[model samples]
Target: MSVSKKKFNLVVLDMAGTTVADGGLVEQAFSAAAWQMGADPESMIGYVRATMGESKISVFRHLFGGDEGLAQTANAAFEAAYGERVAAGLIVPIPGAREAIERLRGEGRSVVLSTGFARVTQDAILAALGWEGLADFTLCPADAGGRGRPYPDMVLAAFLRSGAADGVQEIAVVGDTSYDMLSGARAGAGVVAGVLTGAHDKAQLVEHGASHVLGSVAELDGLLGELERSS
Candidate 1:
């Protein structure tokens, strides 16, 4: 199932739901922040979801209405709770994530991880997955001027860092959100793949410019074949 009509030189992947299951940790952290602030815990999910692909501080600003003091407060609480949660070692790589990354690397394709997570959090996940040195490049939102998803900064940063800038036409952006798809499209990447493993539904992803949507990363292997052939 070769999806690429021409093999891509590089593939940029989103970290949270695409490379690892940090969604729970994120939700938990937000919940704690809401609780500390005496806000509705569930309501915070909607705010945080909107910040899915942005920098931590930017997300905090978005969540707390740009009040620097409140953002600082919420951020501290969120980080504290999230750090404790992660220390319990509950997060894990999504199914087929490791295999897919290994497969892509084995094929000599450069693999870059572009994510909205904080650099510290991203580094922790990379270490936990034993992928710190495996990935060709790992880019955090901070490098992209603290902008979040729907902006191409993080993806572009990874592209530049991976040396894919030379072959930007041969890069794909894969993630579980419309933000990722839109970012990829804006970046002029070869393909924008949306997965259903996160909070977004298929309709939402497609509505936002996903050229292809899969049920999960487990289905990506075959989809890539089709994508390659079609490319």
Candidate 2:
């Protein structure tokens, strides 16, 4: 692939399943909310998984059945349940993620996080991982300006925040979901690297146009170095 044009000084990462396994937290929270509303737990989990990468309101509506009032109530219940469990220690960064971030920063790349979760939740994950100030910038769904992943809004927002808007050619979007891959492609990012550390598999990532797929974030150090050298 176009290695020369794919060299990037900036790398944007996705939080949640990519950086941390918050899917468990999400499922737990949704189940509790659904139970409170007398809904089936299994059904709620299916609903939540389908609505991933969307807004909180959308997720609640999809999970607990879509009346605005029910959605609002469900959202509050889910968040409360999630917050309590998060406080009790459920979220943890993926293996070797910290080392990968440190290595990238040490190599002079500007790193940023672009997430579907709220800023508060993102902060909690970072804190849980003890990864304070690890990234140059962070972009949450709220900061995404009405567009979420599978769209390019959040990725582009992170790029702008990292001072890479004018140099989009030198940015790579590394994520673990097809939403991340499609988002990067739509944003015109030169390279989009998908990892198997999150929800989707290699075939899914490829189907969504991921430029490369690796086993995990830990493999990033070598692959990224190779990309730079080839560039």
Candidate 3:
């Protein structure tokens, strides 16, 4: 891995299942929408659970390949259902996540959030978390004009937006899913860390190329500090 002269410059976070508590609502919504759109229930829900960190449209497209209109309809239903769920319930922040983020910011690290949810659902979630403007930037796949997790686009977008032009290795990406780990690794981030707070466990994360596996994002600050000192 390339080492940066500056320990680290940016941290790209995954919103759901990392900074925010997911509690499986997104999977529920996605599964429901897919079933309504004529997908087989058994395979559909499983696929969704596996790719929950991915963009809704991407999952739909993969499931309903060549049926762009059907995929679009399913995506709309997912967003609508997910929006309603958020509006009706009290969404909570993951334990210690807000504090950890604040600590990182105190140390002059640029932090941003990338999510699979579209802008509308992300907006409702931010409002619920009271996390508006909490990060330097919060991005959806659409915001960066790229496919979501497991792809490098969103992480690269965060790197650019956070002013990290020279040292890609000075960037860290943290999330609870293997997709997030893959995204960070594919983007050539120095620290592709995975947390167990959302989806995958330690083995799954490691298999996906996570260099550091924490119990949760709560450990991120300390982990980075250790990396900085070790470097």
| Candidate achieving the largest lDDT | 3
Cα lDDT tens digits, model 1, 137-187, are: 788777777776788887777766766435666787889877888898888
Mind giving the per-residue lDDT tens digits that candidate 3 earns over 107-163?
Answer: 878889889998999999999778888888889998778578889999998887768
lDDT score, candidate 1: 0.76
Give Cα-based local distance difference scores for all models. Answer: 0.76, 0.75, 0.86
Stronger candidate by lDDT (2 vs 3) = 3
Candidate 2 Cα errors over 4 Å, as ranges: 1-6, 62-66
lDDT of 2 by residue, 159-227 (tens): 767664346767788888777888888888877899897777899888887999988877777887897
* Model 2 clash number: 1
Each model's TM-score?
A: 0.88, 0.86, 0.94
Residue 92 shift from truth in candidate 1, angstroms: 1.0
Give the Å error, residue 37, model 1: 3.2
> What's the count of clashing pairs in each model shown?
14, 1, 0
